[model samples]
Target: MAKVLSLILGGGKGTRLYPLTQSRSKPAVPFGGKFRLVDIPISNCINSGFRQIYILTQFNSASLHTHINTTYKFDNFSKGFIEILAAEQTFEHDSWYEGTADAVRKNFQHYASLEPDYYLILSGDQLYKMDLESFLDEHIKNGADVSIASTPVTRRAANDLGIVKIDETGKIIEFHEKPGPDKDISDLKIPPSQSDGSDKEYLASMGIYIFNASAMEEGLDNKDSDFGKQIIPSMISTKNVHAYTYKGYWEDIGKISDFFDATLNLATPVPQFNLYDEENPIYTKQRDLPPSKINSCTINSSLATEGSIITDSYISNSVIGIRTIIDSGATLDGVYCMGADRYETLAEKEENRRRGIPNIGIGSGSIIKGAIIDKDVRIGSACRIGVDKMDRKDGSYENYHIIDGIIVIPKKTVIPDGTII
Candidate 1:
C-alpha cells in the first residue's frame, strides 16, 4: 500500500451559507441531524483506509477543532492520527491562507515530514462515497503525476464547476473554471462510452486530487493559490495530470438552498447519498440518547433520530434531529429540525410552562414548512414558518431569515406564537 496522507481543506468563511456559518466554519455546520460537514470527508478517509489525516482551517475553527478532538480517536499503537492545522503567522509567512493551494503549500513542511508517497486533497463540505485505493491505484497504473476524481454532471451544473476535457485515452488535456452559459463547453463534454445515459453530461472535477509527493511540491512552487483557479490549470500544460471518472452521488452544499435540499434528500426513500450504508457508515460524534417516542403522530417520509418525541403531531418530508419534541397538532413539512444540544429536565419544562414559554422544541398547533429549525430552537404554538407568499427571494426577520425561499431559524432562537414569515 502506498503511504498516503489525507488533507481535508476547511472551506472559507462560508458566506454563502451564512447564519449557519455564523458561529461555525462551513465544515463544522451541522448536517443530517447529528453529523457535521467535516464528518463526510473524514469518514470517507477512514473508510478508505487513510487514517493519517489533517484538517486545515483558519476562520472560526474552535468548534471544528473540538469536534475533531472528541469524535476521531485512534489507539496509540497505530500510526494513525487526525489533527488540525490552523492558519498562523509564522516566521516564513505573516499572512493567513490566501487560497486552497496556498493553505496546503504553507503546510508543506509538515506534510513532507510524513514522507508520504501521495497526498490526497479533498474539500470538507462535499457529500460523496468513493474508494481512494482505487483512485490511487489508477494514478500509479497510469503513471499520473496528479489524478483528479471527476464526475459527469449535467450542463446546467457544469457551468458552476471546473470542467475537465479528456482524450479517448482518459488523459485530461484541457480544464476550464466556471464556464458561463455563453462560453462554448461542447468540446468539454464526455465521450459516449463514459456517459451513463445523460447526453448532456460533462466531466467536472470533484475537488479531490491525488498528487505525487514531488509533483505537489513543484506545483506549489509558484504564486498560484487555488487549484481550480491556478495550479491545476497551470499544471495540465506541464505535469502529468489525469482524470478519474466517477459517477456517483456527490453534492457541494455551499448555498442555503442547496443545503436545504440536500438535507431533505437524505430522508428520501432512495437517497442519492445513502447515509445508511452498513459497509461504509458515516461516522460522527455519537450521543447516548434514548429511543424516539412517537405518540399517535401521523408521520410520513421522515427520519427522526433518537431522544425525539412527537405527541400527536403531523410530520412529512423532514429530518427531526435528536432530543426533539413536537407537541400535539404541530405540523412539520420539509423541515430539518436539528434538535437541541441537551435535553431539558422535567423541572425545566415546568418552569417554561409557568413562564408562558414553550419547551425547547416545536410547540402545539404550529405549522412549519420548508424551514430549517436549527439546534435548540423553540417555536411557540400556531406559528407559521414558511414563506408568507411563496416568494423565492431572500429576506430577514427577527431571530430568523429566508434565503432562496427556505426559512433558516438560527440556533437557540425563540419564535413566538402565530408568527408568520
Candidate 2:
C-alpha cells in the first residue's frame, strides 16, 4: 500500500454558527447529540484505513484540542496516530492560518518528516460517510495528480458552493467559486448522463481532495490561500485534476439553520445520514453513564442518549443528548437539547433551590419548540421558548439569540421563570 497522510482542516472562526461556536471551534461543536463535528471526518478516515492523520486548527481551538486528546488514542503497536497541528507563530511563519491552503502550507514542516506519497485533505464541518481508501485507490488507478470529490447539488445550493464543469472523461475543465445567483452558471451544469438525467443540477466540490505529494508541493508553492477559490482553479490548467462524482448524503453544517435541521433530522425514522451503520460507526468519547430513565413521559421519533432522567414530559422529533434532565410537564418539539456535562449533585440542587434558581435542565411546565438548547442550560418553571411567537426578530437577547428564525440558547445560559422567547 502507498503511504498517505490525511489533514482535516478545522475551519476559521465559525461565525456562521455563532453562539454554538462562541466557546469552541466549529469542529468541536457537538453533533448527533453526542459526537462532535470533527468526529465525522476522523471516523471516516479511521474506517477507510487512513490511520496517520493531523487536524489543523486555529481560532477557539482549546476544546478541539482537548477532545482530540481524550477521544482518539492508538495502540503502541502500529504507526497509526492522530494529532493536532494547531497554528502557532513561529520564527518562520508568524501569522495564523489565513485560509485553507495556507493552513497546510504553514504546517509543511511537520508533514515533511512523514514523507507521504499522497495527501488527503478534508473539511472538518461536514456530515458524510465515504470510503476514502476507495477514493485513494481510484486516484492512483487513474494516475491523476489531483482528484476532487464532487457531489451533484441543485442550482439553488450551487450559489454557496464551489461549482465545477467536468468533461466526459471526468477531467475538470472549469471551476467557479461561490458564483452568486446573478452570474450565469447554466453552462456549468452537469450533463444529463453525469447527473442521473437530472436538470439544472451542477457538481459542487465537497471540499475533499486527494493530491500527489509533488503536485501538492507545487500547488502550494505560491501564496494562493484557499483550495476552492485559488489553488484548484490554477491547478486545472497546469496539473491533471479530475472529478470523482459521489452520489451520497452530504451536508455542510455552516449555519445555525443547517445545524438545527440536520440535528433534528437524526430523530427521523430514516434519516438521510445514517448513524447506525455497524460497518462504519462514528466514534466519539465513550461515556460510562447509566441508561436513560423515563417515567410517564411520551416520546415520539426522538433519540435520548445515556444518563438522562425524563419525568412526565412530552418530547417529539428531538435529540436529547447525554446527561440530559427533563422535568415533569415539560414539552419539547423540534428541539436539540444538548445535555449537561455533569449531573448536578444533591447539595448543588439544594443550593439552587435555596437560591430560587432552576436546576441544570428543563424545569417543570416549560414548553420549548423549534429551538436548540445548548449544553448545560437551565430553564425555570413555566418557561415558553420558540412556541408562542413567530414574530421574534433576529438578534441577541438577554439570554438567547434568534438566528435565521431559529431560537438558539447558548451554552450555560439560564432562562428564568415565566420567560418567553
Leading candidate by TM-score: 2
- Candidate 2 per-residue lDDT over residues 316-383, each given as its tens digit: 99999999999999999999999999999999999998998899999999999989999999999999
The numbered model that scores best in lDDT is 2
lDDT of 1 by residue, 1-421 (tens): 6999999999599998988988889999888888999999998899989999999999888899999999999999878999999998889999899999999999987768889999999999998999888898999999999999999888888879999998877889999999977898887888776666865579989999999999999999998889998999999999889999887788988699999999999889998889888999899997888999999989888899999989999999999998898999999999999998888899998999899887899989998889988888989989987835655458777788888878899988888778776
Q: All candidates' lDDT scores? A: 0.89, 0.93
Worst 10 residues of 2 by lDDT: 191-200
Runs in model 1 deviating more than 4 A are 350-356, 387-393
RMSD in angstroms between candidate 2 and the native structure over all alpha carbons: 0.9
RMSD of 1: 1.6
Candidate 1 Cα lDDT to native: 0.89
lDDT of 2 at 263: 91
lDDT score, candidate 1, position 145: 97
